[model samples]
Target: MTAPTRAAPAREWADAFAAASNEDPEIQAHGKYFTCTYLLDATERSYAIKMESGRVTEVTVDPGPLDVPYEFAIRATPETWRGFGEPVPPPMHHGIWAATFQRDMRLDGNILVLMQNLRCVTRQIELLRTVGSPV
Candidate 1:
C-alpha cells in the first residue's frame, strides 16, 4: 500500500487549534467574544487565521496581501517554528513570550488586543505541536 498523505501544515494546524480551543474551558472562557484576524509569517510562506470567539474559524494559506484588515501578525522563520513545534521545545522556543524575546519570532500590530487575548493565543500556539509537523 502507498503511504498515507500528511495534511498540509496550515490545514492541520487550523483543525487542531479549533478542536483544542473548543475543548478547553479556560481557552473558551478567556476568548469569549475575542475576534481577530492574525497572520502567521513563516519563512517560506504566510497564513491568516480568523479566530471568532476563541475558535479558529478559518485558516487561509499563503494569502499574499489583504484588502481586509488584520489585527496583528506573528512572524518567525520556518526553523524557529519547527523548534516551537517540538514535543518539548527548548527554553526560548517553549512559548511565544520566550520566543519573541530570545528568538526571531515577532508580534506586530494591536499589541493591546493580543495581550487581552493572551491566554487563548498561547494555547493556540501550543496546539501547533499537536496538529502538524513543521516544514
Candidate 2:
C-alpha cells in the first residue's frame, strides 16, 4: 500500500499558494483591481497574504503579531482548515460562508475588504485544494 498523503510544510504551502494565485485564470481575469492584504489563521499557523493588482506579492508565514498588518482575517481550528484543504471538501467545509456558520471558522477584522475582493479571495482560498493546509 502507498503511504498516507500529507500536506506540505508551511513555507512550501506558502510558495505554492502564491504561484497558484498568480497563475489562476479567474483571479487574473477579474482581479485587475483586487489589491489587499489578509490573514489566514489556522490556530497552529498563520499566513499573511498580500495581493497587488491581481498578483500575489508576498506571503508571510507565521508572522509575528506586529510583523504584518492586514485588513481582514479568516480564522479556524486546524481541524476545520483540514476540511478546506481537501480536493473536494464535504458539507459545510465547501466555502467560507458555510464554514463560518456551520463550523469553527471566523471572519474577523475589516470584513469589508473581504467582500471587496470576494471573487479573488474565494479563488485564493480554493487554492488550498492544490497547496494543502499549512498546519
Candidate 3:
C-alpha cells in the first residue's frame, strides 16, 4: 500500500475542532465557556471555536509563525464565573500559565473571543476537579 494521504495538518486540525465545538453536549448544556485554536500558514491564518462553555478567562500570545512550526498552541479551562478578574481568575490561580506561547509574538487576526473561550474551558475544568466531579 502507498502512504496514507493527509489533508494539511492545520486544516484537518481546524476541522476537527470545529466539529467538536458544534457537537459538544456539555458545552450546550452548561452555556458557559468557549475556546478556539488558530493556525497561521504561508498565505493566511485561520481561526475557529474549538470548545466553549462558561465565560472566557485567559489568552496567550502565539509565537510568530516563522519561528514556530505550527504557529500556536492554546489551552483554555472554562467555568461558571460571572464577575470580572477582581478576585483572580481560575487559569491564573495556578500562577500565570503563560498566556501566550511566546510572550514577544501575537496572532495576526482578532482572537479576543477565542481567547475567552479557552479561559472559560480551563476554568470550568478546574472547578470540576476542585469539587471532585468528573470533567
Candidate 4:
C-alpha cells in the first residue's frame, strides 16, 4: 500500500454549511436569527463578512480552509474591550441567553473563535481572575 496523503484543502466550510440548509416549506416559515454570506478577499488577504441587512448572525468553523456563503444580515457584536476589574456582560457569556441569541438570533457559531481571541488579548485580565482578583 502507498503512504496516506493529506486531505484536500477546504474550499471553504461555508460551501458545506450552505448545502445543508433545509428548504422545506415548514422549515422556511420558521424564523431564524440572521443570515449573511462571507467571501475571502485575496486583495485584502482577509475574510470579509457581507450582510444583507448590514449585520452578521452566526458562523461555525471546524478548522482548515473554509468558505462561508453570503446570506442574511443581522447586527452582531464581534469583540469589545472591557475594563480589567469589570465583570463581563451576561450577554457576553456563552450561557442560555447567549444560546438564545445563537439559535433564535443566529449568533451561535464562532463562539470558540471569540473565546480564543479573548484569551489571547486578555491574558493579563484572565490571570488576575484566576488569582481571585475581580474581573
RMSD of each: 3.2, 2.5, 12.7, 15.6
Which regions of candidate 2 deviate over 4 angstroms?
1-5
Instruction: Please rank every candidate by TM-score, starting with the best.
Output: 2, 1, 3, 4
- Winner on lDDT (1 vs 3): 1
- Candidate 4, which ten residues in sequence have the lowest lDDT sum? 77-86
Q: Candidate 2, which ten residues in sequence have the lowest lDDT sum? A: 2-11
26: Cα error in model 3, Å: 3.0
Q: Whole-model lDDT for model 1 versus the true structure?
A: 0.75
lDDT of 2: 0.89
Task: State residue 107's C-alpha deviation in candidate 3, in Å.
Answer: 7.9
How displaced is residue 32 in candidate 3, in Å? 6.2
Where in model 1 is the C-alpha error above 4 Å? 1-9
TM-score for candidate 4: 0.22
TM-score against native, each model? 0.83, 0.93, 0.29, 0.22
Q: Model 4: per-residue lDDT, tens digit, 23-69?
A: 22322333232234433222212233432222223333332244554
- Each model's lDDT comes to 0.75, 0.89, 0.34, 0.29
TM-score of 2: 0.93
- lDDT per residue for candidate 2 within 16-132, as digits (tens), equals 999999999999999998888899999888999999999999999999999999999999988888888889987888789999998588999999889989989999888888878
By lDDT, the better pick of 3 and 4 is: 3
| lDDT for position 127 in model 2 | 84
